[model samples]
Target: MARVSQEHLDARRRQILDGAAICFARNGFHATSMQDVLKEVDLSAGAVYRYFSGKEALIAAIVEEVLGQVRDGFEEAALSSPPPPPDLLVSSVLGRVLESKEFLTVDGRPAFPRLVVQVWTETLRNDQLAGILHDGYSAVQKTWGRIVEAYQDTGMMRSDISADRVARTMMAAAMGFLAQQALFGPAPHEILRDGLRALMSVRDPYDTTGGSQLG
Candidate 1:
């Protein structure tokens, strides 16, 4: 038998994944069986199984792609000459996720966000998924912590604040924005930027003594 080119194998895997993404997006993970995905791709059971053993495997691949996007955005910003402001970084990061082609369905709609919401619900019972999410989050937090350090070096934020705490705090807000976006329709990225600006602009009027404004 002639050996299949690596390109051909990749295309086949993509075909299966794209089909699975559609099925999962429309009917969800639990409701959409392997047979449904196979039907969607017009592939035999052996062919689809060669690429993914089950829905969890498919979900893992999709989650990894999104997490990679998050890390790439943060890493790029952290390595820039001047790291982005906290608000700008948050909005940009969210924008990258929403615009990622890997998350988009065949219909040009973002499918991963809704799929992730479903994954979040599934994680309560699926330890493997919870572990995957935990690992992905930890990796992003580390990069985000680096960004916090970069901001501190530039005097953009408080030096007294722990970088880990700041990273986690900012990450929490960003994830909250993502959940909101997934549940509701898309909102202006300016909403996030404006909210952060308002938060950062608050003055400590009661402080008479000289102290850090906690900006």
Candidate 2:
């Protein structure tokens, strides 16, 4: 038999990861069996081992992959054209959360969200995961912070407002909204839009009614 090149190995690994994503997203990480993924991808159990050591490794890979996409998305949004509006900044972050559903359709409803929620809980118990999740959140905050700074520079926001603080608060609000959505199952975009409106309102503190302040 001929040897497979590194490229071939990596391609196969990606395929396995894709399968694992579907499994994790659908079945919930704990509920998914290696055999389930193997069957989904039509790969033998032994063959799958060549790509991942075990189920836990597969879950970690999925986390790393999804989180990487989110990080990349936020970075890309920073470079996005038209200069991000405050509402759009929140919209972008919320959009990414909703996009996790793309991976969830593979196994079951609430699959990827459930896994991420579990990871959030696990972070409370595991220092390493906590650090990873925390850093990921910080990256999100920084991305939004840059957008807020841009808005401030253009006079869309109050010059005195701190972009970093606003960004951190927005992301924190987003995390809370995600938790709420997971619990209540309101329309996905509903919380996102509402949240963005609330965040944007901070920039406009006065209303036609003298007593009404946006902030």
Candidate 3:
């Protein structure tokens, strides 16, 4: 018998993970079982287990995959010419999060938000998962902090505030929005856009540079 190529193995693993994500999103983590994943993938038990040892392993892979997509978005934004303003930056990132097909149901509802909340709950009871989550958030924070600092240097953001703090605040707000969206569907884009602009200290349109003071 001929041995399977590495590319085939990788493709098989990705296929299983995709099916597992759909199952977890529909039935949630605890409610979802390996059998559910197997059925979703239409693969034999042996084939599924060859990629992930258990549900926990599948969950870990899903988290890593999601985080990798987020990291790629950040990198893409950072490399763009005439980089987006802080507000646009935040909007861009969150837009990608909300619009990602990887985390959305076929009916246009978000799946990842529910899964993320489930993971947060799991982290409370699982120390290993907790560490993984903490590490992922830390890396994301560092990336955002760099962006915040650049904006501050250009006087686009308040210098009085700590870059790290701003980054953390933005991250928290984004997570909150995700949770809210998952529960109530998406808020108005304009409302979200304005709120992010306010948070990022985008210059007031009516305020002229060195304008005469009001009498």
Candidate 4:
């Protein structure tokens, strides 16, 4: 007769989402069913349905959770006390993608990349999922656009290039790197570190000759 506490309800929702993520990560979203999620969670049909109406709802929740973390990561970097160097900021964000426990499979592989590919494929068929992904990417691009403008104003980045262009380019590069990592294993951190340095015009740490300096 006792009512479920708010914390308990939230925990249950998270449990269901986690199980769904694992299922979708292993099997493509189209191949995954509500029954698969129920079995993964070891919960009854009614119990799982209480949190998510169906597989689509569960996929939405998973995408939102992943996108939320990405947005928060960029926001945090932008608002740092002493703003991180461009290369560091980019490296830091990508590094977290490599390190995030939430994205890892039980066998210690990065599951997010596979999930991302599945989501992209599903977006072709599912309008709702496409909209959700579009909104998430828009939010991230807007935040990065602001950050790029701020860097330009500070002379840390080239003012000649458009902030919107730079933001889009950066996002594309990040996504490309993630896709590569997800398909293969983790990439050397130095590859991303150096790549961001070149893209953002950050000064090379190894170059002691101060011919070209970064703001």
Which number leads on lDDT? Answer: 1
Count of backbone collisions within predicted model 4 = 0
Taken over the whole model, the C-alpha lDDT of each candidate is 0.80, 0.67, 0.74, 0.79
Question: What lDDT tens digits, residue by residue, belong to model 1 across residues 95-149?
Answer: 7677654455635656766676777887888898889889989999999888888
lDDT of 4 at 189: 53
Q: Choose 2 or 3, whichever is better by TM-score.
A: 3
Query: Who is ahead in lDDT, 1 or 4?
Result: 1
Q: What range of 10 consecutive residues in model 2 has the weakest lDDT sum?
A: 206-215
Model 2 lDDT tens row, 65-169: 666766677677778653666566566656766675545553235455555666676566667666767777777777777877776666666656688888777
Candidate rank order under lDDT = 1, 4, 3, 2
**Model 3 Cα shift for residue 176 (angstroms):** 1.2
TM-score of each: 0.86, 0.71, 0.82, 0.86
* Candidate 4, residue 91: how far the Cα is off, in Å: 2.6
Q: Which wins on lDDT, candidate 2 or candidate 3?
A: 3
